[model samples]
Structures are given as structure tokens and as C-alpha cells.
Target: MRAGRKYFIYDVFTQRPLDGNPLAVVIDSEGLDTAAMQAIAREFNLSETAFVLPPKNPTHKACVRIFTPDYEMPFAGHPTVGTAIALSEMAEGNDLAGIFVLEENIGLVRCAIDKLNNGLFAEFDVPQLPEQLPLSADPEAIGAALGLGPHEIGFENHRVSLWSAGVPYIAVPVADLKAAAKVKLNNDAWVEFSPRKSEFAVASAYVYGRETVDHTSSFHARMIVPGNPSYEDPATGSAAAAFAGAIMRFDQPTDGSHRFWIEQGIEMGRPSRIRLEIDVAGGKLAAARIGGHAVRVAEGVLLA
Candidate 1:
């Protein structure tokens, strides 16, 4: 057995522990392999585990690889935010703070950490949003995977399509909040109609509604993938970015910025808030982005 340091991982996406999605941060994983990383992730058995590595190229930012207990994810939102927050916090008493760049496996992501009177907030640039695609999934098939019928979907301007910011997810639009909260992953239909490989068939279901909770607009969503403790994430930045891209493609008003509030994790009792912005120019999707606040709940070191 290998003896090293250990860290006290905490749940991100919420201000308190055990509220949001839990992530394991193995801060000192210098000599671990893919199998070892997966093994450690399984040992922690959280929704996701992050391993930090030294930067391969100094010209870029630091490198980090994220993994679910069972599989490695090319990109993830909470981990990205949480890992940055963790690194920034660790930089205390050191020389790493303010604005920094992370050389993730996906690419170079720029992040800024600022300490405000209220708390710490992190803003990071996601990979450019992807182009919109046609509704590839059969309605019946998509509905089956989501435990919904065609009637429940907002078929007027929305469609079940594929989108990605860093990783891809099957984007399904529901009629309203009620239908969105009642969503259940249709494994059978998902197995057939989903455009992404089985590994990335994490379905993201959302709906647009009037001001509810504490925001002007409410977006309810759920994400489902196999072998993970949490099938539904409270706040998904990656999916939200893709959703903004899809919105720009299908439902942009003639003028001004398209701004909306995205809500997730409420059904699971962990309510999350995300702000999405998209700009459509000349009837083409021009710019897409998302931003939110991240707070540190706790910290620890990894033992190997």
C-alpha cells in the first residue's frame, strides 16, 4: 500500500458541506496512473474526483484531469470551479492568486479569483460554444429516455438536440417547471437516440419560466449518467453553456443581449443558480458564455 497525504474533500455548488455535489481533490497526486486515479476516485466514491498535475508547458496554465469514480471526464463545471477555488485558496501564504490560467486537458481556461467583502468569487472562460445541430433524436425515443411524452415538451420552438461546451450532453427542453422537475432519464431511448457516446450521454433537461425563487428567470435542469452517485447535478455550468448556445440558435429576440437565469439541483434539495449570456448577430450565434460564484467549504491534502 502507498502511504501519502490525505485531503478532506467537500461538496461544491453550495455554501455548506453535504449540500451540493461532493468532489474529491487529490492535491498531491504526482505519480499516479490512470488506473490509480480511477481507483482513488472509486475509494472516495463522490460524484467527481480531481487530480492536479504540474503544468506541462509553462506557456499555458496548470494542468488538471477530472474523473468520475468510474470514468474520466474531459471537462466538468463544478470541478473546474472547485478546483480553481481550491488552488487559489491553497495559494494563500504563497505566490498564486488574482488571475490565473489553468491548462486543463480540454485546453487553456482563464480564471480570476477575487476576495470581496462578501466572499470569494471565481470567473472562468469556458471553451467556445459549439454550433447548433438539428434535432437528431426521434421524439418518441428522446421522450422515452426522459420519461416524458411529446405533450409535456415545449415543442413549439424547442427540440431535443445535442450541444457541448467542453463535453456534450443531450439537451431536452420541457414545457415548464413542473414537467422539468418530474423528469427521469429514459435509459432505453437514451441508449438509441443519444448522439454522444454512452460515456457522455449525460442528458440535460431544462425549462424556461417566469421569475421564481430569487431570480428573474428560472431554469430547472437534471443530468444523468451511469455509475455515478449523483445522477442529477444541482448546478451544471457545462450544460448551461451549451443551453445558452442552443437558446441563441432557436429563441433569440431581435435586439439586445439574451440573458437568463438557470436553476438546477432544487429537486435534489441543493438549489443552484447560474447566469447565462448569449449574443446572436445577423441571425447567427455569435457569442456564448456563463458565470457564477464559488465558495470554499473546506480543504485537505491527498495521501499517496
Candidate 2:
């Protein structure tokens, strides 16, 4: 049997412990296979788990593999941010302020780290710009899937749209926070609404509303994956990455750098705040970045 591997648990996207999304980072995953990694991720039973491996490129710091309880992800936001902070802390006493490239399935992601008053702060540029996918589910079908009426499925110019930065998600805008909170996934309806042959076959529905708990927050969001043990994700950086396109397409922001705060997981009692920044030039999206704080909560060894 292989020797025990060390793993750290982190609460990401929040300053305090137990407030943000929980992540398990397995260090020294050099010898583990894909099946083992997937099992470890399922063992942790969090929204997502990360496996840190040696970088294929000499210049990159590390290659990270992200796995949900069900499947491996090409790229994920919390794992990227949390892994950077964890590695920075592991290299404590060294200069942590700089750019580090993390090799992911999507590509090499450039992450910036800095020492903060609360803890370590990490932000990474979206590996790919959000691309719009053809909408396959209509408002009525989407509403039925989410146990909402057609009227509650969309607000203003915002409607149901499919997008992806690295992973795909169906973005559904609601009229108010109450409407967003009322969403409950009807699995049967969802399967019918988004079939396996559809473009959004493996996508989650990201329901959001303009109203937020925090006045500083621009929106309140919730993500529900049909088969995850945790029915609702506390925080979702990948979804936010794709949301940049929806913001640009609908808000029509002027040419400049714009920042927005998204509040999520309030109902689950693990409130998480995500910082999203978008750069626009001549009314076109130039870049997108996601930033957040992660606090180390626990550390242990995994015996497999």
C-alpha cells in the first residue's frame, strides 16, 4: 500500500473558518491514480477536492486536479484559490507575493497571491473567456425544473442562458431574492428539461437574483447540481467565471474595469462572498478575474 498522504481542509471565499465553501486539498498526490483521487474526493464528501501534483512544466508551480464527489472537473474556482493559499502557507517565511501558474485540465492558470490582514488572498484570471452556448431549455421548462413558475424564472433583460468559462452552467435570473430562494430542483423535470443530448447535459443550474443580503453585494446566487450529495453548493467560482459574459451581455457596462460582489449559500447557513472583476474595452469583454480569501481549518493525513 502507498504511504499516507497529507491533506488540508479549508474554508474558501471567507475570512473566518466554516463560513465559505469547504475544500479538501490532498498534498503529495504524485502516486495516486485517477480512481484513487476520485475516491478520496468522495471520501471528503465536500463540494470539491483538489489533488496537487508536480507541474509538467518547470516554470509552473504545480498541477492541480479537481474532483467533485461524482466526476473530475477541468477547472474550478475555489480549488484554485484555496490551493494557492495553502501552498503559500506551506512556504511560509518566503515571499508569497507573486504570480504562480497552476496547471489544470483547461490550461495553465496564472494566480496572484498576496499577504492580507486576515489571511492569504489569491486571485486568478479566468483560463478562458466565457462563451455563450445555444440555450436549449426555455423559461417554462427551466422554471418547471426549478419548481418555479415561468414568471419567476427571468427578470428584466436577463433570462435563461447557457455559458461556460471552463465548465458549463445554465444561468437563470429571477425577479427577486425570494424567487431565487424558492428554487428546488425537481430531478425528473430537470432530466426532461435538460437531456443528455442537450448542450447543458452536464451543467448545473445557477439561479441568481439582483437582490442581495449585503448591500455591497450586487447579486444573490445559488448553484444546484442534480446529483451532488450536497444538493446546493455554498460558493461557486467557476459559475461566477462564466457569469462575466452574462454581465457584459446584459449590463452593457462602459469600457473599463468593473467589480461586483456575489453572495451565496445563505440558506445553507454557510454564507460565502465571491469577488468578480471584468475588464471591458470598446464594449467587448477583454478579461475576467475571480478573487477570494481562504482560511485553513484543519489538517490530517489520508490513509489509503
Candidate 3:
């Protein structure tokens, strides 16, 4: 690695700079090993950092590996969008073909970048959805962790379950935004519900209400997994994806472009938005998708 190689980093899920989840992008990660990648992620101290490599199979697309400050992630949402947009912006003049496949630990993921008059839009696909788990029978313990009583948690037809589009999360419904804003990591209860170790499992928390925010129909969220890397993610695409799975499980809302918006981080003052869409028929999950626009917050060289 050269001493002056440049890297581009962006705060994804938010259009404004430094207001979203900060992602460190290592534009040229050729010879850096696993240990070096982890070290670089630690140096950036962000929730996730992307290391881009030349496609192992040129027939595929861009090869990328993702790492958190503590560990590597097989699949994640914002990194996919942010990295694809970065590559699309970089490959403007080149003869790179259409549909870039980002080969990662999860597998080969196809990404498409849209350069519209509005701005840049990046959309990526999750290979498969995580199996749905039954909602938690013990809402009291879960409720107490979020400083809410059982009644405060909504339980009409919706059940809190572990759903995933990429990574899994305990998806629960909160009756109000007030409760959502007060969420903090409940180490004790989370220990019981989360499958992964305390470090990985309890990654983020979300809360949404039908028609809660502006023009957002029937969904608003706040992500609260923030002790180590980030204070709070303004917008979390992975969590949004998980929430999309949860939404499909509960209310398989009508087809014909069922679009909804997710609002997060307003309580903490970051104020991020995520756009969501899903296709369902006869109570079967069909297609789950999430898209968002990313703006490059900062760019500099990642000194190797």
C-alpha cells in the first residue's frame, strides 16, 4: 500500500454531511489482510468501514468486504449503497458495464446506481430473508429494558419477532415516539433475547407508528444500539430492512408500490430518513426493498 493513497468516507442514510451513520471507505484495499482491515476500522472508529478490492471474478462486479470496529460483517445495507454510489461516481468515464456485483462475505450482491436530476440513488438486494421467529412471549422484560411498561408496547396484530433482510434484529413496536426516544441498551434483557454475543446481537433498536412522521404512512423508527462505535445512527438501512421484514410479517400491506418512509434519530438531533417498499400477496412475503440517497460528507486519503 502506498503512503499517500486516497480514500473516500461518507455518512450514509442522511443527505447532509456528518449527520448520518459515518462509514469509512478504503477506496484501495489491495494487500491489506484481515488483521489490517480490523485495525483500520478501529482507527476510523466508525460502526462499519468498507474495504474495496478489485473484483475477484471480472465477470461479477466490485468486490468489497465490510468491517466494524470490532468485527467484520458478511452483509449490511448502508455500506452496500454507499460503496456502490462511490464506485459509480468513480467509474463515470470508464467502460465498466452495467449492474455491479459487490462480492462480500455474504456472497455476491448486485447493486444498481441511479443518477437522477434529484441526486444519486443506490439500491441493492438482500439475497434472502431470515426466517421469522415467534414474537417474544415475555414483553415485560423487553419492555423494562426500554424503560417502558408492557402496555406501552403495541400488541394488536403485530408481534415482536426476530426478522432480517441482511442481519437480524429484535423488531418490536412502540406506541409512541416518546418511548422510542428514550431507548438505551438494556444489557440484561437483551442478553436473553439476542442470539449473538452481547457485542453483536442487540445491534440496534427501532420504534415506528402508522403515519407518525410527515407523509410517512404507518412507520417511524429510532435506532438505539450506540455504546461503542456511533452515538446514534441517523438512518440505519439494515435496521430498516429488518423492520421491512417485520412489516411484511405483520401487515402484508397491498401491492402496487407500497411505499413508506422511516424516520429516525430525530430525538438525538441527527434527523435521518429512509425510504421503504415491499411486495406481498396472499400473506406471503414476496419482495422487500429499501432505497436511499447518500451524500459524500468527507473525502481524504487513508494512509496505509
Number of clashing pairs, model 3? 3
- Please identify model 1 stretches exceeding 4 Å from their true place: 6-8, 59-61, 94-97, 198-212, 226-230, 253-259, 279-283, 301-304
Candidates by lDDT, descending order: 2, 3, 1
- Where is model 2 poorest over a 10-residue stretch in terms of lDDT? 193-202
Over 90-118, each residue of candidate 3 has an lDDT whose tens digit, in order, gives: 88586323476889887878777775446
lDDT tens per residue, model 1, 1-304: 2556555475665555566666777776667889998988888877788888788888654688888777788777777777877787777586435887877767777877766435455666666666565556676677666777778766467776777776666677777667776777755555555555335444444443332555555455666662223266667777777777667656655545677777667778877666676766777666655555556455655554
lDDT per residue for candidate 2 within 1-304, as digits (tens), equals: 2768899999999988989999999999998899999988998989899999999998998999999877788899999999998888887577777788999999989999987765778999999999998877778888888889987877779978888998878899998988888899887677665534223245788899898889999989999887523288899999999998899888899999999999998988999989999999988999999999999999999876
* Candidate 3 residue spans exceeding 4 A from truth: 94-98, 134-137, 197-203, 226-231
Q: How does candidate 1 score on lDDT? A: 0.67
TM-score ranking from best to worst? 2, 3, 1
Which parts of model 2 have CA positions greater than 4 angstroms off?
Answer: 195-201, 228-230
Cα misplacement distance, residue 165 of candidate 3 (Å)? 2.5
Query: Whose TM-score is higher: candidate 1's or candidate 2's?
Result: 2
Q: After superposition, how far is residue 37 of candidate 2 from its true place, in Å?
A: 0.8
